[model samples]
Target: MKIMVGLGNPGKQYEHTRHNVGFDVIEELSRRFNIPLDQSKLKGLYGIGFYKGEKVLLLKPLTYMNLSGESIRAVMDYYDIGLEDLLVIYDDLDLPVGKIRLRQKGSAGGHNGIKSTVAHLGTQAFNRIRIGIDRPQNGMSVPDYVLGKFHKEEQLQIQDVVQKSADACEACLERPFIQVMNDFNQ
Candidate 1:
């Protein structure tokens, strides 16, 4: 089984913020694959789906961003899956918006969610799909930009990027992490 965990805060208020792109990707996959992530347990709302004949666990952690690892560790242990079988998705501010970087293993790059996950998992090695949320121009603060919603034009661009990220995730289930990193990282 493959575990795909998306990191973000839960609840209505954080719904459309740039930080919630991870949740958005999971939602997109849920809607597209008929996964019906109606169950809530292990500190998350998730479901199982078959992608390329592989059983994949689609997770949106409800423990919020900083404590996301608790949810991830719980699910992974329950399924007896190794860290290598895990795929994480989250927003990134370092890259330009509308781009994604697939990494087989790497540091968190100051992402609290990823940092927490790595700490709990006890390793820096894990597959990740980073959806670029873009750094603010003109010296705008990082927190303000991440917590904010996208502009009208950005909304369309981000939606398209999210869909493409989902496709890349699907491809990961059918291919090796090295292959995915080489093909999807940019």
Candidate 2:
């Protein structure tokens, strides 16, 4: 089975913030596949379904961004999911807005959610999908920048990017990670 976890804070206040793009991607996938993320367990809301003949568990962690690993770890333990079968989606400040990157394994690069995930998982070797939120400029703190909502123009672009990210994720279930990377990492 494949487990896809999206990292974000849980609440209306954090909704639509740049940091919540992970949640946005998961929601988009939920809509695209009719996954119905209505089951609550392991500090997350998840839905299990078949995508392209592969069993998939779609999760939106409710532990918020900073402690997202707790939710992921719990579900992994219960489901016996290994690192290779796990893919985490989250926002990246290193890339420009509306861009997306697929990495087989890497450091968190200052993402608290990824940091916590690495800590709990005891390794940095796992699949990750990073949706760029762009870095803050003009003296804006990183936290403020990530937690802030997107501008109107950015919102439009991000909507399209989120849909693309969702498409990339679905493709992941049907092909090799490297192939998916080659297809979407442009």
For residues 28-132, write the lDDT of model 1, one tens digit per residue. Answer: 888877788987999989999786688888999999899999999998988788888998999999978899998877898999999999999999888899998
Score candidate 1 by TM-score against the native.
0.95
Best by TM-score: 2
lDDT values, one for every candidate: 0.89, 0.93
Per-model root-mean-square deviation over C-alphas: 1.2, 0.8
Cα deviation of 136, candidate 2, in Å: 0.9
Clashes of each: 0, 0
The candidate that wins on lDDT is: 2
Q: How far is candidate 2 from the true structure (C-alpha RMSD, Å)?
A: 0.8
TM-scores for all candidates: the values are 0.95, 0.98
Which window of 10 residues has the lowest lDDT sum in candidate 1? 177-186
Clashes of 2: 0
lDDT of 2 by residue, 1-186 (tens): 999998999999999899999999999888888899999989999999987788899999999898999999999999999899999999999999989999999999999999999999999999999999998989999999999999988988899899989999999988899999999986
